[model samples]
Target chain A: MSGAAEQAPVLQVRDLQAHFRTHYFGVNREVRAVDGVSFDVNRNEIYGLAGESSSGKTTLIKTIAGLLKPPLEMVGGSARFSFLPDWDAVGRAPPEVVRAIRWRHLSYIMQGSMNVLNPLRRIKHSFRDFAWRHLGGSKAEFDLRAAAHLERVKLDPSVLAAYPHELSGGMRQRVTIALATICKPEFIIADEPTTALDVVVQKDVLGMIRTIQQEMGSSVLFITHDMGVHAALTDRLGIMYAGRLVEDGETPEIFARPLHPYTRHLIGSLPRIGDTEQREGLEGTPPNLATPPPGCRFHPRCPLAMSVCTTTVPAMIETLSGHRVACHAVNPGMAA
Target chain B: MSALLDLDRVSKSFSRGGLFSTRRVAAVKEVSFALEADKPEIFTVIGESGSGKSTLARMILGIHTPSSGQVRLGGRDVTTYDRRAFMAEVQPIFQNPFEAFNPLKQLDRYLFMTAERFGGASGKTAAEEQADVALRQVGLSLAEIRGRFPHELSGGQLQRVAIARALVAKPRLIIADEPVSMVDASLRMSIVNLFGRLRDELGLSIVYITHDLATAYYISDRLIIMQKGVVVEQGPARAVLSAPTHPYSRQLRDAVLTPDSAGAFRAIHSRQAVATPGVSS
Candidate 1:
């Protein structure tokens, strides 16, 4: 893990910012969804990005995947992937670059599997459409490659003949996984892949993700709002809030000793099956990104908020072993 | 203590397919449970897809009539209640926060509608006040969310708004279907904690439905484990979860991922290697 961490990251995001700037009836508003966020996803590692909706986690992943559509635009920062290094150099990369990189070197397992698969088209056609071009071989070779990918994810090859609607939700997701992985991408961005799944099936899907990630040696940017899923699958975790990375550390360390008040509250609020702790809800709703709080965005909801917190944005500081936090209460330098 | 809501051998079946090939899909079969009115508590219904937990929730809410048996709300048959009265007594918070409210409409409109309909708030001002109070209960202010669209607010904020809307009616029961499933991990806890608070402070009974058991055990006082519409087990939350008697319930419990057992999650990955038959089909 340390060796991979030290190496040039497979996906290096530096101060990446994607904002939703809208003009409605002569009024202009900018939502700072992913504001000055930086992270590195190394090869063969599962980097868990945990944040609530509106935390900008989704925007961050979307920006990384080159799937950004306006009114959500890349305001600033660079998302540099090892495979797509030159793609970002020009304002618009060539179609061949995009076509070659997609699924071949970069893949995404989305929240809704239906988003990728055509409802009318059979699963085999979808596979062929996605992987056939990239495989660059005879139809039989592509078919064999697709079957091998499905087999790795523990999906039956028979699903290829069925339509997406004919298959169950879990099966469709597995097919999506198989679709995304058939080309053996170096980086995989999974955004809430199992959020819609049942508890039993969620377990199955997550297990597949872990197994495939390990076996394929692909770096995964696994994003979910469920800390439990993050704890289970991710080796390292980063907590995002108000479009910024608030904390980043080992999964176990963050779970055991969460530094940021927001992270602390988030971890404390989790309902363990056996342990029944009296959990308190965070005091206020997340700030509207169009006009976020004056200083620290989370200050309105942080129980330990001080005068400084309302005035100055706290820097994410490494307070303990690989644990970084962006909060005035936790990091002493920010305290006034 | 008599049950506030009771389902006696209740079942719901839907016929699918063409006229020539008729298929009877048993969404809920022989499901029986009771929610004590006197002892108001959050009673969770746990199941996977096709577990029939949601179908049962809809029946309790009077949104759907049971094909057989009885679903009594406060000793009165649910199907017999008038729409207004049933809605006043039981409100719902749907699974998808984005789809719950009309995209064109402001979020506050739902709150005012509930307030006017259920709270008997005579005028616009009174309804606004009622809506404000309900929002406050869910840790939100009406001023902040008054003109906001569903897309403007985060999933957590939207779900809280949904819950607050449910509270505006001051219903005896709130049927929440996967309320926090879409909300982010950090935001999910806050919503789950709110359910606990509502039960304690407002004395409101909640029919919390989800495939997630960790939150179920955290807030639920008594829970029923359901599988393909069958009640596998029903008892006190702690007792049943800690020592589940039924094999299905045990399987569901074991599938739960806790922070402590992060390393152990891999073991349960292969437990369900065989794909189970679809109950709906």
Candidate 2:
């Protein structure tokens, strides 16, 4: 693990900012969805991005994958991947290069299986559509490779003949995973891939993800709102609040001793089976990113908010070894 | 004491397929449970997708009629109750808060309308007053929600408003089908905690339906574990969760990911690998 840490990161995102510039009847609004976020996915590491809806997690991953469109613009900063060094910022890369890099070098497994797999088309056709151009093989060879990939994810080859609706939700998700991993991409972006699955099926699907990642020796940027899932799957976890990463560290460290107030509240709030003790919910809702609270984005809901928290954005500082937190109250300029 | 809500061997079946090739699918099969009238408690139905938990919730709420047996509320057949009276005594909180209300309409309209139609509020002033009271129960004010569209409020706030709308009718029983599932994690506890408060303070019975075992364990007083339209286990929530007797129930419990159980994925992987062989690591 120590040796792996010394190796260069597979994906490095530095001071990234992506904003949604919307115009409703000439009324201008700018929602800073991803504001100065930075992180790195180490080689062969499963880095979890934990946040709720509107926390800019999805937007950040989209920016990283170079999936930006009209209103959602990459305003500043960089998303640098190890494989695509020719492009300084992948989000700003040329369309042809993005198309060339996608599937072969980078792939994504979305939350909803229906989003990836067409409802009308058979599962095999969907696989062919995504992986065919990258695989560069005859139809027969593609079929053989697809079957082998499905087998790896524990799905039978017979599923290729059936429509997406015919299979169970869990089975469809496994097929989606198989489609994403057919190329053995260097960096895989899985956005809440298992959130829609049941507990029993979720365990199996997670196992499949772990197995595939290990076999491919790929880095994964796993995004989900569920802390338990993060705890189970991720090597390192980053907590996103509003549009900023409030805390990030090794999963066990974040779970054991969370430094940021928001991180502490988030980890403390999860309800466990044997523990019947009442857990306190955070006081306020997540700030509206359009006009987010001035200083620290979480100060309004932070229990330890001081006057300084309202006016200045807290800088990400290291509290413990490998644990980085952005909080004025906790990281009072004292290095651990 | 008499039962507040009772399901007596109730079952629901749906017919699907094209003409001349219809197939009958049993969605819920012979599910029986009861909540006592005097003792309001959270009765949770835990199941995965296609486990008939949602079907059972729909049957209890009278959205779908049972093909066999009966669902009785306060010793009265659910099907027999008039729409107004039925809605007054029973309300529903759906899974998706975004879908619960119309995006084009104001959020508080549902609350005021429920108060006027089912809460016995005669005039606009009375309806607004009732709406305000219901919203207060969920820790919101009409002032905050009034005239605001559904898109304006956060998911947690929208769900709370949905609960408030349910409260406006002053329902004896509320059938919540995965109410907190869509809400953010930090706010999920508040909504779950609200259920306990509703049971204690408002004396309202809730039929909480979810696939999540953790929240079910946290809030439910009594629960039934369902699998493929059959009730696999039923008992006090704590007892059933702590030491599940059924094989499926134990599997579900063990699959639940908790913070304390770090590295649980590897354990689950190996165990399932033993059950179904030949999948490469």
Candidate 3:
């Protein structure tokens, strides 16, 4: 927690592989949900992951959160967190160790607020159920802390008594953010937190998340398919396609000059106000993970795909300092 | 040279309570607009949940009769048309393609059924011919989707099939409710572009209802911004969005998350969160 060690990335994931192995009837198949992905979430920085659905972003999040179950198994590599030097990944960490770190060191804010809160229970009980065990104190002290935290997040303390159904979607989401940050965790993984909300609500919630992360000095791994959200919130950005990290760079750099063809397509496709240029949708669908295309998975739809990309897998290479891309077209001089 | 679709101060209210004290809730409040029969255009309705956009679409599709005023189609009250004849003139494309089609049924069956019922096809071959034509318009061929179930196709492919099904009826107007919201980024523009193409090539007026204002600006010829069942602003899509006069419309436009907006939003974080609205139906 001090000196040069503080400079290291909070989370270092290397060559990670997670696959969904299912045996339906007689056929046994493996969907390479997250194949050979690697990234670093630095301390006190918001790292954004952008990709289309079925592109393995969600699977990657689940694997990182240690929420994997039967059929979805981690096949290879490690996700090392700075907090736990003894274990390489949360998935490999034992139940006792994981329970200790679940909310104290790492927390998650999901899309559906109702899913986090028990519908039948009051907001206070839901907060108590999750945080009281982690933040053990006298019941009175804990209640005071919870109310203070809710007020800090701009909710009326009276809302603590209200049921989840009574609060609006935006308010419920704000409560979810407050609950996630109450422990003052070092890292927060927000999975499409604002996707369910409208434009007005989304902007305000994102502002709160930004403000809280800044005030708490905690790193956040923000994942969403929306480019605008990534542009508005993240410091660093990574683009995933077919379970692989295709591009990673500073958010502004990635937006200014997107290196990978898929990244280019994703950035180019976004329609904005005042701009009247026609944006053509990328052709073909995302690859089916169970039977992804050989070599580069995005080749079928990629306009800049080369002969080398069809046969050989491109290694991630730095075209510019602090910016990395894994595409044969971008780094052609490199040996295949 | 009559109006293709005319809504004259239409209003719809639903009873919300049990037997003791039932109170009427106005879902749509006196909304009015019209599309010309000869001039096909993509008319967009922009609103969030509970904004009455969907309710208005249903009334246009003849699902609900307006509580007051008139919804005239081909210069006649919408309720006056026979149900089957009404469907032949207006088809609907729902948000989720997975839910729109039966999981057990083949995708082509939906298209063929629409063709047989609305396209005046008599036999299987006749239906197939009409279905294939509609599918081809959507850049999909019958051979590729003939025996494929809804689960077998991707969300994008399934949505295209839904659009194809709508096209199969050769309807004069199509009502798409949040059609591209469930679709991925790669295919979203294609589906949105498909709407514009449907207007130009098929001469079909599309009542595209959605919350995504960016896409509404991109494809729509005319648009109305609805807030809480009221049309706060209505005009050409570009002019209204580029320079909205209404305060609510301006707020909605300002809320759009772009790179610049995100950069400029650092100040809003300092503001109190309680000032934000709590309830949106």
Candidate 4:
């Protein structure tokens, strides 16, 4: 892990800000979906971003992957990949450049496997549509490469002849992963890949992800709300709250001693088997990002919020060697 | 005392493909279970997507009749009971909160309607009063949900409202199919906890269906594990989960990813690596 960190980061995202601009009739509104997020995915390491729905994790990944359209705009920030260093501005990259880099240098495995694999076509055709152009080979050669890739993911090559609907959910997801990594990209963005899967199949899929990432030495940006998945898979984890990163550290360190109050509540609320001693849910709902509270976005829900917390926004600062947190109560007397 | 709900060798089958090339597929095989009338408990049915858990739930709700066997409520077969009489004794909470209600309508309409239709409330004032009582049982009030639309409320609030709607009829049993799965993690426990409270205080029997083992262990008194429409294991929830005897149940338990089970990933990964020699170390 230390050696992996010593190498240059595969993906560096600095102060990224993505907001949703909605106009209904004449009224204009702005939802700050991803507000000043910064993180780094070290080479060959899995960085997990943990956030509940509408915490802007999906928006952040979409912004990074340059999938943002109108209404959803990347106002500021730079997402630079080691392979595409010349194009520091990922969100604003040219279509040709983005297309050229995709599948060869960067690939994505989204939540719904159906979204990636076409239901009307056979699995092999979907593979051909995605990775065939990226791989410089004839049709027969590409077919061989595709079969070999499916074998790597522990899927039968016979699945290529069947439609997406024919394969089971878990099998289709594995095929999606195989398609994404067919060219052996340098970086992969997996957004809740195994979330739709059952627990039994989820473990196998995650094991495949870890094994494939380690074999290819590709940096993976894994996003899911499940802390259990993060504990088992990720090397480092960043906790997101109200569109802002509240904490970031090694997986075990953050789980053992979470610095931020929100992180503490998030990890503490998880229900485990053999432990049923009246676990309480966090009171109040996540703050609405469109009209978030003043100062800190989470101050209204924070149990230890103080007077200063209402007027001053906390900055993410390093308290331990590599751990960082954004809470005034945790890092008292720290200049805002 | 007679059993409240009795499932005797119930089975459901569905046909696929075109008219000429039709194939029969059994969604749920001969499954049997019963709930006693005097005692209330949480009975859980655990299974994966295609494991026929949903099919069993539909049969219990009378939405789909079993191809074989019978589903009896209070010693009377469910198929013979009238719609109003059956709904008055049994209710359901669906998986997705957003889809359970109409987005354009106020959230309170369903509660008020249920009260009027099933609670013997004729007047608007009487319906409103009954709705308020039911909402109070779920820790909500008529004021908070008076004119609010379904989109205005969060998933947890909407689910609680759904539960309140079910309670308006004073049903003996509630069939919740993955109710909390769509809710946020931080708010999930509150709903699960509410079920526990309902069983204790309100004397409501619930059939909890889910793929999540942890929550199933927390609240269920008895549970059955299903695999591809067949029940592989059934017993006391805590005892069975703590020490599963079936090979499939043990495999499912071992596959569960807990915070403490980080080593399970490495073990599975190495085993997979050996199975597929194509993966370069």
What lDDT is obtained when candidate 2 is compared to the true structure?
A: 0.89
lDDT of 3 at A221: 97
Give every prediction's interface RMSD: 9.7, 6.7, 8.7, 5.3
Report the Cα lDDT for residue B14, model 1: 95
Q: Report the Cα lDDT for residue A80, model 4.
A: 84
Index of the highest-DockQ prediction: 2
lDDT of 1 by residue, B1-281 (tens): 77888989999999999999999999999988888898889998888988888899888888788999999988999889888988888999999898888999998888888888887888899999999999999888999998999888878889999999988888999999989887766567789988988999999999999887887887889999898889989999888998999999988887777677665544433322212211110
Across B1-281, the per-residue lDDT of candidate 2 in tens digits comes to: 89999999999899999899999999999999889999999999999898999989889989899999999999999999998999999999999999989999998889888999999999999999999999999999998988999888899999999999999999999999999999988898899999999999999999999988988999899999999999999999999999999999999999998888776653333332222212111
- What share of the reference contacts survives in each candidate? 0.47, 0.54, 0.45, 0.44
Flag clash pairs in model 4. none
User: In CAPRI terms, where does candidate 4 land?
Assistant: acceptable
Clashing pairs in 2: none
Candidates in order, TM-scores: namely 0.90, 0.96, 0.95, 0.96
lDDT of 3 by residue, B165-230 (tens): 999989999999999999998889999998989998888999999999899999999999998889
lDDT of 1 by residue, A268-289 (tens): 7777777877765665567778
lDDT of 4 by residue, B1-281 (tens): 79999999999999988999999999999999999988999999998889999999999999999999999999998999999989989999999999999999998889888887777788899889988988999889999999999988878889999999999988999999999989987788889999999999999999999999988988899999999999999999989999999999998888887777754544433323223223121
